[model samples]
Target: MISSVLVANRGEIARRVFRTARRMGIATVAVYSEADADAPHVAEADQAVLIGPAAARESYLVADKIIAAARATGAEAIHPGYGFLSENAAFAEAVIAAGLVWIGPPPAAILAMGLKDAAKALMIEAGVPVTPGYLGEDQSLARLQAEADAIGYPVLIKAVAGGGGKGMRKVDAAAGFAEALASCQREAAASFGDDKVLIEKYVTRPRHIEVQIFGDAHGEVVHLFERDCSLQRRHQKVIEEAPAPGMSAEARAAVTSAAVKAAKAVNYRGAGTVEFIADASEGLRPDRIWFMEMNTRLQVEHPVTEAVTGVDLVEWQFRVASGEPLPLRQDEITLNGHALEARLYAENPAGGFLPSIGVLEHFRMPAGIRVDSAVEEGDEVSPHYDPMIAKLIAHAPTREGASDRLAQACAEVEVWPVKTNAGFLARCLDHADFIAGDVDTGFIGARLDALAATPEPSDEALMVAAAAALGDQDGPATPWRDLTGFRLNAAPETTLRLYLDGRPVLASLPQGDVEADVLITGDEVIVFEAGEAYAFSARAPIADLDEAAGDGQIRSPMPGKVVAVSVSVGDTVTRGQVLMTLEAMKMEHGLTAPFDGEVEALLVSAGDQVSEGVSLARLKAAA
Candidate 1:
């Protein structure tokens, strides 16, 4: 058995690995950068080492620093948790070369499945079904365009080295192919340093279902089952669940068996996920499913698989890394119940899902559920890393029951100041199509406007906020009674002025206590409803409010670099015209004109880093 383990990652990834290490009675080592010096994972580890500065290039991605930390701490092995150096074949090889066990698959297997184009060819040879596509060596734009025409319209151009939805584009027709190809290649080079791409037929209605397969050094491979990660936005998964909702017995058998075969083809060891894209224009069928790519590490959604199978995947990884034989035969793994996992990110769904960065002044997750979190109350959500603060998982005897529980859990979340996607996740889980298992990768995008719109505070919430802003009542007397003056029950109908999200509103309370959880932080009164936070402060209505409007000031929504400037000063633009594009938190956001106006000033240029609320451009109202 491995005596000590060092996790070469940060945030919840490291924390999760440390948890299992402790339970197994093995010592845990944590390596952190300066930005994560006070992180929970660092404090919980048996030994900690500082690797580098805040930038990931200088810290987590530096394999030499990680190896040195492992040696200095007398660590027996290194576990590359999900991201950063987790899938880096060179880093895995380096760990082995330094006389420390590498708790992952062999370097050769990683390279075999690292590129999507090459992996598909290998899977085909292994008798696993793969999606029809063009994976030739030609890098010419004309060649890619020709391939798309042959593949038919609505082709998906994906980076051969891409994952996590980056470096991919969908072209609906021949006219859009060239521009989409350029954008795809640019993103591919920037993200992966590999500009090569492959074109495939894009299923109009695609469901992302992946099989979790595990292997041992003895060449035994078994699958745990399948997970539906179809609920996504912009190619990124938001919610995931196991045993796919509408998967037939035959479909499940086929997908899981193919996954095991793919693993065997690479002589794979430890945890790996074989992702398959299902054409769901009709429904999930064995013939409609095809292999897309393979993730050569433990997936973030592995908890749902564990919940259904009653198996500890981390423990299995440890056993396999120690050169042990398979822990369980193919028949030993049984799917029992249903489980759902929602990523709780520090982001504002209403504000175009922009990443929210701030100190978590008030953070609370619902009780009686599995929560893997990185930050606690008072911890800052820095802009230097992924904005996902935690993952909320729920399990029940049935799929419907699991969905209901997970929705309730999202609604009960209470985080403030720093926004989160809890409300959006709750809405998604409660959506009618989602409940009926009629979902696909385009589900969120199709209904983004509805799901991202911030709901108005309910009357009950308004009353609660009003009462809290009024302060304590005199000796058990209802706060509503005091607001209407000390008059003797004269049909108390006094309206008070309050600001909700900086907008003034007239509020009145009923005679009794409002049934809602309220948090009073400083002068701000916050109320949580359906997983949404409404902050209110009592104050006089602002005069000349229109002066602030129609100013034509385009401010940066969050801290990021200005990737492109599409308009110049004195240019006339219509409302909603994209003026510039800002790259933040690994996503591009287009800043648009709020109204039809002429550009009066361009305050910033391309490549300039801007902070949140900084005015990047301004316009003059059209005469």
Candidate 2:
């Protein structure tokens, strides 16, 4: 029996695995890098061990280091949370060879499904449906181009070992195929250390659905229905839910069976996910479903499956690792209700979704909802790791109710200092297409303009701000009243300027209670009147206001080393023009000019390590 387990990853997944292990009376151990020394996962475990330096390649992905940590802590098993080295076949082999139980599928299973091209071929041989495309051995530029031509336009060039859309691109016309392939290859090489790619037909308006399958050493296997992960941004899932919104019974059954067959083919043990792409333009059908790939480890979106199925998948992983038979039969497993999960990322939605890093000053999530977070209020969102702060999940009797409850929970969640995607996620839930369950992978891209519309401040809210600002000073009489000013016949109208979402707006208050004209210098507002004016009192900086505005310089969006400088002092640039690029979290974000103006100063240069909100450049006001 496996008495102790070591989680070989960091953050929420480690915390999640520890929770399950503790429930089963199994001791849990945690391994951390230098940067994650104070991370919550390390503190949550029964024992902790330091592996190596801060870089992932030095710590988390160092198989030998993780194994040594497990050995030092006397852990009998290792659970590799997804990403890093979870799907690494050699890592699994090393763990088993070290006389530790590998709490995942066999290495053979991982090898079978690790490569997308290989997985597709295996699935086809196993009688599973696969999309028509090229999975040939030749990877020459000419060969791939020919495949694209034969498959027609709108082909998707994808890395054979890719996930999270890191190494994927869609070409709408043959003219852009070569450039897209080059870009995809570069990203694939950087992210996965493998540049080999494959081409497939890009299904327009496709729904991403995947089945959760669990297997045991005794040859028992069962499917846990399906989850819809179609709502995506930049090909990364933002929202996921169980018992997909508009799934047909026949389609669900077919996919579930195929998932079980896929697991059986690989002699898979423990938990795995079989992903499928469904043509949603015509609605879901059994014939429309095609195999995508399989995640050989526990998934980040597994909470929804647990909520609806009433099963702790982590517990099952431990049980199977202990050489136990399947806990429940296929007939006993059933979906109870609807469940939804929203990823709370430390990213700014209005600012191109660039990852935001800072010390979370205040973190408050709703009480009733399930929150799986890896960091605390005082914890820092480092540039070396993933930007996801937490996962908020809600379960209800129906899909609409679950979505509504999740939205309410998110609205109440407050995380100060660091900009988050909370507001944007709430907007997505309230979106018409999403609420109606008529969304696809292209939902965010299609509605980018509409969804990014900024909210307007209400009269009451503005009044509150003005009142707070006015009450802060020490004056004989009220600022709006006549005491210091000389003339009684005419009261002076004061002009107040404030920044909202990085843009300036002017408020003009007349002497009396009559309405005043307000000028919004930015784009139009959809939810409220942007330029409408109201009676003013004063203004004060609230907790939500950007603290960096007082610094008089534009800061980097995330923690990263500056890669390039586009301009120096006295150079004029327009809004949306690239200022510099910061590479972090395995991605590069271009810092852009906030407004059209002359560059006053450049604070940093290439190769300088900068934190989020560190001043990088300054823009002088336009004449």
Candidate 3:
């Protein structure tokens, strides 16, 4: 039996595992990078170790450092959380070699399903339905192109060694195949250290569905059911739900049985997920679904499965790692209710959903909601990691009820400074199409314009901000509060001007002069209106003079490392020429030329870390 454990990862997952460990009376150890020395998970652990610097490779990805930290802390087991080295066959083997229990599937199981090509072949031989793809031995560029052409247009270039939507791209036609392949390969190498790729036929109107499966050394493999991860942006899941909506009993049975078959074929152990893609053009059907790949670790959306099945998957991981029998037999497991999860990310949905980074000045989840988060109000959201702030989950007797509850909870979110997708998520939850369960992978992309449309504050909300600015509410009065339309023997109406998301808006006291239900905290105001909350920033002092952005100037949109400076001074460029690539929040953002121009100054270089609004280059307009 394992008495102590060290989580070999960081962020929310670490915190989550620590919670269960504490409840089980097991001592917990946390390993952090330089960037996370003061992180919540580190503080929560009974013992903390600083392994390396901020970059994951220098810290979390270094297997020796992680194992050494575990040994130093006298940890009896190592739990590799999702991402990082969780699915790394070598890392798992090394952990076992160190005489410490590995709280996951065996190393051979990881290798068997590590690569998409190899895993697909294994699944096919196991009599499981597999997607038609080109996973050949020849990784030559010409060979890949030939296979992609045969697979037909609208194909996907995917990295064989990685998951989490990284190193994957969709090619709509033959003309863009080469560029997409090269980009996918570059990302694959940087992320997973394997540039080998596989080509697959992209399912039209796809719905991403995955079955949660578990196994033990006793050869028992049971599934916890399925999750619909169809709501996605750029192949990354934005929202997920358990007991997928509109799923027939036949379809669920087919997917879950297939997932179990795949697991038994590999003699899988512990918690793992078998992912599949279904052609949802006419909704879910048994034969329309095909295998995608298997994730050989705990998934980010495990909570929803737990909510519906009343199973604590992490606890089972601990039990299985200690050589315990399966928690319950396959025939005993049953689904309970419906559950849904929405990921609150630190990003600007309006700004093309670019991941945001900085201090979370006013972070607060809605009261009475299940929130799994690792950051507090004053925590810094560094650019060295994923920008997800938290996962908000809701459980109810029905799917619509769960969706409604989550939507209301998202609307209750109050965050500032570091923008969040809270409002955007709220819109998605209540959208008519989403309510009717008419969802596919392309649902969000197709309705992005309407979903991302900025919400307008009500009249009462505007008055709240105005009243707070004037100090006319239940607070200490400022000297300026008494100066509103001051006139001797004369009555006059006064108005206040404020900026709502950078747009000027006029506000005045209501007819009753009653304060709205709002919370004024210094310069930030949280206005509660119609059961929804709207956060507004105080207008900055107007500048007497402002400089306009010239077409030739290119500035960094977010703070990050300059991964690539593609242009030099005097280089001729076109309207959309990529001058440099800035990597932030683990995604690359391109700084391109505004128009046809010549590079006049290259102010930044590769490897330099820059802040948002930093001038990276200046281009001179062509004569």
Candidate 4:
């Protein structure tokens, strides 16, 4: 057995791997950047090392630093949890060269399936069904356009080396092909360092189903069932489930068998996922589903499979990497109950899913469900990493029951001030279409209005905030502090003015001393109502913040690096014209002109990092 393991990742996945490693009595090692020095994963590990600075390129992505860290710690093996160096074939080879056990598939397997263009060819030779598209080595624009036209309209332009939807675009017609190609190529180069791309037929109604396959050094591979990850936004998965909803027995058998074949063909070992896109325009049929890509490491949604099969995949990885054989045969793995996993992101769904950065003033987990998280109170969510805060997983005897439980769990979330998609996720799990298994890749996009609708703050929350403001958490203070800022020396007013959800709400408070489940922190108060907490600040409404902004100014919404400046000084632009694009939290946000105008001043250039509310450009207002 492996005596020690060093996790070469950060956040929740590292904490998750440490949990299993601790349970097995193995010493856990953690490598962290300066930004993650206070992270939970570092504290949980038996030994820790500082690799580099906060930037991933300077830290986590640097292979030599990781290798040196492992060597100094005398770690027997390294676990590249999910992202970072997990799929880097060269990194795997380097780990092996350093005389460290790489707890992942062989470099040969990663190389075989790392690139989509090459992987598809191998899958085809292995007799696995692949999506029909052009994987030819033609680098000309005319050739790609011709292939798109031949494949018919609405084809997908995807980076050959892409995953996570970073370098993918959907083009509906020839008129948009040129711009789409350029944008796709640019993003591809930025994300994967590869400008090469391939065109595919985009399935309008697709259900993303993937089989969890594991193999050992003995060449025995077994399928651990499948997960339906169709509930997605911006091409990223939001919700995932085990034993895909409404999966026919025959279809399941066919797909799982094909996934196993793909794994065996590459002589795969450890945990891998063979993702397939099923055309649900009609229904899931064996012939309609095709292999999309293969993830050569543990997936983010692996918990659902574990919940159903009662298997600990990380433990399986540890065992396999320790020269162990397959834990169970294909027939031994049986699905028990339905399970659902919802990814909770620190993003505003109502605000078009714009990711937010903040310090978690208060963070509380709900009861009666499993939650995997890495954040706590006072921790900062920087603009340098993925915005996903945690994952909420629920399991029940049936699919409908599992969905209901997951919705309640989301409702019980009590994060304060930091905007989250909890309400949005609750709605997704409870939606009629989602409950009835009538979902496709476009399900969330089609019903986004209802799903993203922000609910009005209830009166209960207002009173609770009022309680906190009155110093009720500390027995209503000596006198009473209310909207008037009257101390306990002065009698407090019955009504308190509070800024709740960006508007003033007069909340009636109890006279004299009062008590409530609340806390006053800084300029804000967190009030607990029915197990969920709401943040409020009781004071005279500050004059409207947006009132100072003049027309025709394009401002950056958040602190980010200016990736592109599309307009120069004196350039005429129309309303809704994109002036600049800001890259924050690994996402690009465009700053557009408010009306038709001429660019008056360009304040920033490409690659300049700017702060929130800073004007990137000023435009002459239209007469």
After superposition on all CA atoms, how large is the RMSD of candidate 2? 7.8
* Model 1 per-residue lDDT tens digits across residues 508-548: 86565445567765556678888899988775446554446
Judge candidate 3 at residue 79 and give its lDDT: 98
Name the candidate, 1 or 3, with the larger lDDT value: 1
What RMSD does model 3 have? 4.0
Please give, for residues 1-623, the per-residue lDDT of candidate 2 as tens digits.
Answer: 68999999999999999998898899999999999999999999999999989889889989999999999989999999989999999999999999999999999999999999999999999999999999999999999999999999889999998888788989999898987787688778767889999999999879999999999998888999999999998788999999898888888889999999989999999999999999998899999999999999999999999999999999999988999988889999998989999999988776688777778755667779899998887898887988898999999999999999998877666665567788778788878889999989999899886665545776433433333333334444332221111122223555555445445556543454432222211121111122111222233334534444533367876667775676889987898878876778877677887778888889999779997668898887577
TM accuracy, model 3: 0.92
Best by TM-score: 1
Give TM-scores for every candidate, taking all chains together and pairing residue i with residue i: 0.94, 0.84, 0.92, 0.92
**Runs with alpha carbons beyond 4 Å of true place in candidate 1:** 472-494, 541-549, 568-572, 621-623
Error of 4 at 343 (Å): 0.9
How close to the true structure is residue 164 of candidate 3, measured as C-alpha lDDT? Answer: 87
Candidate 4: deviation at residue 63, Å?
A: 0.5
lDDT of each: 0.88, 0.82, 0.86, 0.86
**Residue-level error in angstroms, candidate 4, position 462:** 3.4
Residue-level lDDT tens digits of model 4 in 250-295 = 9999999999999999999999999999999878998999999999
The ten-residue window of minimal lDDT in model 1 covers 479-488
What TM-score does structure 1 among the candidates reach? 0.94
Whole-model lDDT for model 2 versus the true structure?
0.82
Measured with C-alpha atoms, the lDDT of residue 588 in candidate 4 is 68
Q: In model 4, which regions exceed 4 Å deviation?
A: 466-497, 506-519, 527-535, 544-546, 572-575
